[model samples]
Target: MLLIDVVRVSEAVTRTSARLGKVGHLAELLARVAPAEAEIAISYLSGELPQRQVGVGWRTLQDLPQPKLVATATLTDVDALLTRIKAVSGPGSQAARKALVAELFSAVTSQEQSFLMRLLSGELRQGALDGVMIEAIAKASGAPSADVRRALTLRGWLPAVGAAALSGGVEALHAFKLEVGRAVAPMLAGSAPNVAAALEKAGVPAALEWKLDGVRVQAHRSGSEVHIFTRTLDDITPQVPELVEALLALPSTDLVLDGEVIALRPDGRPHTFQVTVSRATSKTDVPRLRAETPLSVFFFDALRVDGTDLLDLPYSERQEILTRTAPPELLTPRLTTDDVNKAEAFFTDVIKSGHEGVVVKSLTSPYAAGRRGAGWIKVKPRHTLDLVVLAVEWGHGRREGKLSNLHLGARDPESGDFVMLGKTFKGLTDELLAWQTERFLELADGPTDGWTVTVRPEQVVEVAFDGVQRSPRYPGGMALRFARVLRYRPDKRPEDADTIETVRALML
Candidate 1:
């Protein structure tokens, strides 16, 4: 398949507003993809690359040669070029990589160049996320959508699932199952206002677990070998030896446990998120970092035990399995109750202990990986909303030349456009400032104003505020008061952002 075909389909998907329309366009494109190009095509249409990283940055993309008048490159050609570029390293490798990038970019037409730029920069906003892509794959391959989604959840790789569905249909998708070594997608939780609301959404006879401020870790143990993965499924087995060793010491030799790794103070309060993430992701001087900020593992759910898959089991059964397999010190502090007052007390105790809040989970719901259903509800004290970054203003003083003040927006479900609510510059560390500057520059839409740089609304950020107030300064007719950034939600897309109606309902 030609690269231009994929670009055109992406454009079509972007122009589409109806979900079925988007799925139809993607399905049509998938039907025409060749078997060899299935993976590349599917990944591109889904706003990702099979190569993952090609060692190219915004600076490298700034000085590209003029695009060709016509498109002639095949999908396979570009994939091979990226593979070669990713392999270039050491002495003069930068120049070699740049030359290859230039060669590849110079061969494409204008539209293809734009698509390639977004695809490389991770800012493709065509709404063809995993959900839409799964529906398309099922439609094209005649496989059930549930089967496709299950395969994606277990495999944690959408392109491979797409290829398998296309080549072998239902039989191939059924082959994907919970394995001891592979990392599956972690189950997510929805948000509620308080304990009562959470219990209402999660139903009675629920298990409330302390929601700690820590990095999510999924540990898979097979005999003596243990592998640890983050929420995004990035393997960091070597960086977190303590976690790996802890999982290996468990009684069950073969099990997949979902948990969190946190750094605690002497009084048992959790350290800042930056401290935990820095220690967990550091690649240099690991021994020293570990000694400085030791991490403690806490298991909450068991996905597999003794080579038996427990993903299909209810939360009640999984909790029993986890309790039996992991020692008490390794389990997250939890409480099971049907009384709302008791649940509220548990939430209050968790908060007083310097934890985030409590996650109320249904006892009978099976593990639904990669889906944020009502099976589990998270209740936090403050008013928090998941908003998208619409634009960013240049910082001044010590933070000069960085993207500092963020213009936050809420999704308008009816029109599918983001409505700007307010701007915030608080709660951003120097590291976050540097990271967002580079990231926002890659998503830059056009020439920036003297102070603000407008970008595509694709980055979802969690914002905590005291309350919402009616205001005329924004399009949403309200603004977040004392708004501050909590963290970036890379696991969520813009489509998952809270709607404007939800924001309006929070008015003081």
Candidate 2:
């Protein structure tokens, strides 16, 4: 199909307020695509490249050659260009890449150019992403949405599952199964305010396990070869040789283990989350860095073993299998109990061990991949503080022209000034967003950046965050981790806001 056709679908999806309307638009486009062009169309419409990274940036795109004002750029043509772009690297490859980018950009119409730019920059403002796209694929193929989601989850790639569903319908989706070496998107949990609430939501006989503050890893071992994947399914086998060796030495020849890899002190307590992230994201000198900052993995669940797929098994069955195969020292500390007292005690134990929190799971729940259902719940203690809102940035897409993203700052008691920890654009309802826009606009300074409206640091907003991290970007040398606005504090003054010292204390 023509690239313009897909662009029109994208535009229609972006323009609609209704989710079903967006899905319908995408479904219509998916139905007409050819089998071979299926992946490219889905990837493009989803604002991603099949080749993943194209190595082009905004600076390189700024001075691209003028468009030809033609709609002749096919999806296949774009894919080929991306392939060439990915191929260019090292030395004079920069100039070669620029030339290729300009050459490709010059071939498409101006509208197509705009679409390409948004897709390439990862700034496709459309609300439609993988979730919506999966629904659309299912709708187009006349398959159950649940089946499509399961297939996509098992395969960890939407385009391929989408193509199969298109070509072979529900049977193709049903044919998809858990493969030993393949990575699947792990099941995620919904959050509850406290342990009792989580247990209530997840029901009785809940399997509560330590929720470690670390990078989630899905390890696959078949014979001597082992592959380690992140929660997002990026293969990181080359980055952590020690992890590979550990998996390779496991008694089970074929296995898939779901767990968290945490950096720990020699005494066994976990290092800070920042240290864990640094160790996991390290790309240079795997063997050398592995010794400097070693990661200890604690397996919480098992999905496959010895060519047997265990995803369909209940949580208890999977846990039993994991305990049987996983090394005792590497197993995540867990408790299976219906008593709220026991669950609460386990939660307290996890906190005392320097972990994040506890995950309460249903005993009878199957591994529902890529879905955040009521089967699992994460219970975390909220740490809240009154912080001053320094500024509010304009929202995007549906939220356009509204004050949404908040610039939160903590009071520096020593200097009597607010220091920016970070910004949060989450946990706001439409009503709250509109109210903030109106209220913050009244307190706006005379001059504004058009995108950001600066205001006096008098409005105190109650913010709840997971924790604080050492950051070089902020003047306070710290930033709030996963910060969200709970509500505006009308009674509190900026002087009563939490201090930088308080934020730093949380880090400790």
Candidate 3:
């Protein structure tokens, strides 16, 4: 296929908000692609390449000697260039794609060319698809996104995994764990509307912990080789050699453990999220990191211990096994207080000692892998609610051309009205602002002008608020103390969003 041909698909993918349009675009492009080009296209489109992918992701980005020079290079020329680069440099080099993109951009007219650049750079985000990347892929493939999702969920790769069946066959993708693992973001909770009551009904004690303002880490081990990964599953092994050494020293352990790796002071007080980020930095700075912002981990759950599936075990049982099996430096502490008063004492103690509130846990609940269930309840006097974005306002300074702040709202349980809870300028990123402005517009219905747009409550957002305050902003004189966009909810709906009544109840 011509480079321009690929550009057209990317153009279509960007402009059309409908899932089917994006799907049709990719399908059309794939039908005409040569074997190698198909491989490149499919691989890149998956967003996550193989664990250690076949080529430098930037290969196409950096290969061009004069990528920004803007000179036309034939698709045949681009193909030949990529083939030559691939043959000479193998998978680690990024030059090929750079040159191909440069050539493609040059070949197309100016307008299409700009879209192509954004497409290649991953700045081409359109919030129109129902939800997530796979849904859009499903629309493109003429199948349910759910079906495509299942195939990838079950098989671990997508479009590319499916596309590869044409040549190397599905067996080739057998070991594929599609989404690149090890980049630790965070594992969020999916809770019942009434978390406390839900746990009571489920025949489990609801233990609540102050949801930490820290990063999550997943440690994977193969014999003595221990690798630490982020929630996103990106390996930070090279950065935390001490952690790896600590895991390797563990006795009777061939495991992958789940925990929060946090930075703390010499006096044992936990630091803020900003400090915890140092644990994810490079090994070259380890000496300085240790000296400046020392750290420790709190192991809450174990996934694979000595090759046993620990996910089925009860929470208390997992903690017991973790304590017995883990090394001192490798483990996160488990707070045990069955009595509410004792738990309260511990919670107060930790908070006063500069720690966040304590997490109360259910002894009998099984490890809900990649889930937040009634087994855990975080009891803090501090007010917090996971809200959904109702609207966004224009930004200024460095944040210009993007959303300045979000019109944060919580669900009204009685009428499903997304009553405006507050507006937040906190946690605004240039990229996020751009992403949300375009996204917030998608949810708009009537004119909610004068710096706000009324949205059809569809997206759920997690907002960590300082406290709820009385405000004349909306019916409830309650507004958020501190508010920010945590993450975009794919599994949750506005109906499932936290409500003002729930927020007020927490005031108790």
Candidate 4:
């Protein structure tokens, strides 16, 4: 199929707000895709590239060659060109890559060129996320949506799963299973105000584990081969030799453990989140970095052990397996209780130890990967909301040339529109400023007014604030007090943002 066909489907998906409409458009495209091109087509339709990275940047995309008047590039043609671009490296590779990108752009129509720019820049926000794509895949392959979702969770790559669904049907999707080395998406947690509320949501006899402010690691050990993946499933085995060594020391020859790795001080208190993340993600001077800021792994749950998959097991059972396979010092501190007072005390102790908060997990609940279910509830001592970014103002002073001040909005459930709440520029690091500036420009919907740039309300950010107060400046009739950004929520969508009603209830 021509690349223009895929671009047309993407445009159709974006023009419609109904979920079924998006699914219909995607399903129709998927059904018409050739078996060999299924993976590339699915990946592109889902706003991803099968090649992952192609060394393209926003600056390179800024100056493109004139697009062709006709559309003739095939799906395979684009994929092959991207492969060639990704292979360019070493000296003079940047110029060579740019030339190749220009060549590819010059061969496609204007619409195809626009699609290529968004696809390469990683800013394609057509709302056809993995959830919607699963339904589309199921509809096209005549398989159950649950099976498609399960296959994606176990496989951890939608392109591969979509290809299997299109080629081999249900049998191929069912072939996916949790493997020792392959990383599955980690289970997520919902949030509550306090320990009592978390416990109430998790039910009695829940396990409250310390919510450490650290990097999430999913370690798999199969004999001497050990692989440690970050939350996004990037293999960091070389960067985290300590974690690999720890996993190799475990008794089980085959195991998949989900946990956190944090840098702790000599006093046993955790370091600041920035310190831990910086140390964990750094790629320089491993031995020196390890000596200066070593990471301590804390296992919270076991998904696979001794050739057995424990994803369907209850939280209590998984905890039991983890306790037997890992040492007490390596396990995250936990307390199982039916009393809210005990849970509150545990939460206090964890907070006092400089941990972030506590995660209250239901004892009888099974692990649900890639989901934020009610089975696990997290409680922190502050007020935080996941709000959408409506617009951003260019920074001044040291932050000049970057997108700094963020205009925050809360989703209005009734109108399905985002209502502006307030603006904040606090809590952004230099790295975050540069990243958001590039991303917001890609999502830009309106022309810049020299001071502010209006963007699509697709980016969700976790904002920490003191409280909410009445304000007539915002259409929501409220504003956040002392609002500061906590972090960007890439895993969440704008639809997952806190509703306007939820923010207003904070006034009570």
Candidate 5:
């Protein structure tokens, strides 16, 4: 199949929100593609070629201007390129890489080579391929939208999901068991200030867990080969050897377990995320890294054990199986007491111990992969902000030729005067950049018609800053720390965003 065909399908699927349209597009591609070429094509269609998990990205337009204008490579060329990369690397080692470089992309100019280099490297930029893929499957099998979602969530890939859509219908899809290797996030929390408050509204028996300040990891062992991946599915085992050793030490072989890899202080409290970062790379020696950070594995959920799928089991039964299968060092602890008062006390203890707040889970809830729902509640510190966008700057580097940065501002709610707060280049997407450029230009009064333009305080965006800090730059003698755009609220006038007084209230 042609690369153009893949692009065509991707464009069509992405444009429609209807799951059926997306599924139909993918099914057509599958039917047209030969099995040999299907893997790469399917990956590309899913927008996962450059694994979103890996943060693989393109050289921005300015860095390689000509390359961005050039047409994307053909599918056959991409397939050939992948084959070359594998051929040079060999099965067991990276010996094949240089050979691939010499044989393939070398012919393209250094500038062009940079562009084609990424394509050959197998990193596609489009994230959330699975959702698009479910759409593709739905389109192909003529199944209902829910059936596609159910099967894909249970089985985790479009090919099998396509088959499920045809063979068993919606029930088959609903009954589909979650399989390993499909990256999914644990159900995120619905928050309340305290457990007693959450209990009054939430119906099920809650499982109180120690919400450790650590990275979430999923460990997969297939025979002797062990892989450790992040919650998002990017492999991180190479960076963390001690954790891998702990995983390999598990008595039950061939398992995929979910847990947190936390840095333990001498006093037994989990360290800040900064200390835990030392253990996240591939080359660190396990014993030494563990001694440096001393990672404690807190196993919470399990998907595979001794070839039996445990995702269908309730949290209670799954916990039993997980605790039994775990090595003593790897067992994650859980508290089942229904007493809401105890939960509040526990939350306070954890916070006092220098940790994030607790995660309250439903004991009876089946793991709801990839969605934040009421089944789990994360009770963390709450923060509020009403900051303004001062000036919009043209995005450079990866975000080239786009509006990716904002000069943040603070408004005097009473006086209606705007003062610059901080600057940020994070969180805006390609679509967002386009929308902002158009909208901000309309709001432009006179100046800022050029590349980096200042805007009126008439538009207010609610921003969440990590913390407030003392700064010499702004008029207020303080700045928004780690500021990120939360959302654009048009509901209220500029005066309605938090007053400078509210910001002062949050400061030390």
Candidate 6:
């Protein structure tokens, strides 16, 4: 298929705010895609690439050659070029990759160039989310949405799902099942503000487990071969040896277990998220790296065991299977309770132990993979502080031309100066962005550059964050993690904002 077809569909999809319009545009595009071209077209529409990251980023795309007179770039042509780009590595590969990108860029028209740029840079703001794409594929192929979703979740690849649906319809989707060594999309949980709310949502006879501050990992094992996948289904088997070794030693040979991989302190409390992340992403000398960080997997749910799929089983039955198959040490710390006070105690204990909180799960609910259903609910104690905005950066893509990313600061009580915690562009509505853009200009300390504008610290905004981490880059020794603007605190003064000492206390 021609690249123009994909580009036109993406443009139409982005131009519409209606979900059905987006689905219609994609369904129309899918009908025309040949089996050979289905994978690439679906991948592009779904805002992903066949080759993943091909050593090309925003900086390299600048000052490229002008567009060709004709749009001749085919799906196969672009795919082949991406394969070559991914192959370029080590010494002198940067220039080679850039040259390949330029050659490919020069082959397409300016309109196609814009589409390719957005797709490559992950700025594909077109509402072609995975759920929408699955529905579109189902609509085009005459398969049920449930069948397509199940296949996509188990297969964990949209391109393959697209190809299967196009070729064999619902039969192909039914053929896709829980396979050992293949990653499945994980079941996710909804959020509640507190334990009482979570228990109320979960109802009675629920299992409450400590929500460890760690990476969500799904382990697949068949004898000596074991694979560990992140929540997004990225295979990190080679990076975490301890996790692999533990899986290999498990009594059950063929199974899929859902859990968290956490690095723990000597006191058995989880290490800070930053520490765990650095160890998880370490690529070189990983065995030595594993010893340095020493990760552990705490299994909470069993998806499949001994060739029997457990996803359809009730949570109570799945927990029993997990306890039976996985070692006791590998099991997550958990208790079955419906008592609000007992659940509250568990929540308090989790926070006091430096962990995140607790996940209250319905005992009778099945594992609804890839969907954030009410079966499981998370309760985490969120700490909100009134912090002053130090500056704001111009947003990009969807948020372009707006004062978005906020530089948050905590007041240092002794010095009476603000200490930068971190920057967050999350949790801001378009209305908030417009309001802040005009309001901040009035409080600007200097002239605006359209890139970043510094503002006086008189405005106090309430910020909610997960926690703080030790940072080497900031003036303060610590920085906020996962911070988001909850709301503006116009009634509060800069002096009334939380102190750096208060922020530091969270680190402990």
Candidate maximizing TM-score: 1
Clashes of each: 0, 0, 36, 0, 16, 0
* Cα lDDT for residue 376, candidate 2: 90
Judged by lDDT against the true structure, how good is candidate 3? 0.56
lDDT of 1 at 128: 82
**In candidate 4, what are the lDDT values of residues 397-474, reduced to their tens digit?**
999899999999998744456899999999999989999999999889888758899998889999999999999899
Residue 314 shift from truth in candidate 2, angstroms? 0.3
Work out the TM-score per prediction: 0.89, 0.76, 0.59, 0.87, 0.61, 0.75
Judge candidate 3 at residue 162 and give its lDDT. 48
Worst 10 residues of 1 by lDDT: 489-498
Candidate number with the higher lDDT (2 or 5): 2
Clashing pairs in 1: none
List per-prediction Cα lDDT, in the order shown: 0.90, 0.84, 0.56, 0.89, 0.63, 0.85
Report the C-alpha lDDT of model 5 over 369-400, residue by residue, as the tens digit. Answer: 65445667666554545566767877778777
Q: Lowest summed lDDT over 10 consecutive residues: which window, candidate 4? A: 489-498
Runs of candidate 4 exceeding 4 Å displacement: 58-70, 89-103, 386-390, 394-404, 409-421, 426-449, 454-461, 466-482, 486-508
> Quick one: how many clashes does candidate 6 have?
0
TM-score of candidate 6 relative to the true fold: 0.75
Candidate 2, 164-231: lDDT as tens digits? 99999999999998887799988887667788988888899889999987888999998988889887
TM-score of 2: 0.76
Model 6 misplaced regions, further than 4 Å: 57-66, 88-103, 285-292, 383-391, 394-508
